[model samples]
Target: MAYVISDDCIACGTCIDECPVGAISEGDKYSINPDMCTECGTCADVCPSEAIHQG
Candidate 1:
C-alpha cells in the first residue's frame, strides 16, 4: 500500500523532501500520489503532524 496524507496534515512541507519517490503533492492539506508512492514510509516518519500513514 502507498502512504496517504490525511487531513491531519498541517501542510508543513516536511514530508515533501523526505519522499524518495516524490509522491507527495503540496496543497491546503497536502496529498500523496498513490500511483507514485513506494510505501517506503519515510514521509510518515518525517511528518511532524503524523498525517502520513499506510493506506
Candidate 2:
C-alpha cells in the first residue's frame, strides 16, 4: 500500500522532505503520488501531525 495524506495535513511540508522517492508534493492538503511511493513509511515518520497513512 502507498501512503495517503489525510486532511489533517497542515501542508507544513514536513513529510515532503522525508519521502525518499520524492512522491510527496504540495497540494491543498499535500499529496502522495502512489506510483512513486515505495510504501517506506518515511513520510509518516516525519509528519508532525501524523497525517500520512498507508492506503
Candidate 3:
C-alpha cells in the first residue's frame, strides 16, 4: 500500500528527501502519489509529525 500524508503534516521537507521513489511532493501539505510510491515507509520514518500513514 502507498502512504498518504494527512493534514497533520507540518509541511516539513523530510519526507521528500527520504522517499526513495521520489513520490512525495510539496504542496499545501506534502502528498504521496500512490502510483509512484514504493511503500518503503521511508517518508513516514522521517516525518516529524507522524503525518504519513498507510493508505
Cα lDDT tens digits for candidate 2, 1-55: 9989889999998887777789988978899999999999989999889988999
Off by over 4 Å in 3: none
lDDT of the candidates, in the order given = 0.89, 0.89, 0.89
Model 3: per-residue Cα lDDT over 1-55, one tens digit each:
8899999999979888888878988998988889999888888888899999999
Worst 10 residues of 1 by lDDT: 17-26
| Candidate 1 accuracy as lDDT | 0.89
Cα error, residue 21 of model 3, in Å, equals: 1.1
The better candidate by TM-score, 2 or 3, is 3
Relative to the true structure, candidate 2 reaches a TM of 0.93
**Residue pairs in steric clash, candidate 3?**
none
Per-residue lDDT tens digits of candidate 1, residues 1-55? 9888888999999999988878888999999998999888999989899888898
Model 1 spans with C-alpha error above 4 angstroms: none
Error of 1 at 15 (Å): 0.4
Q: In candidate 1, residue 5 scores what lDDT?
A: 86
Candidate 2's C-alpha lDDT? 0.89
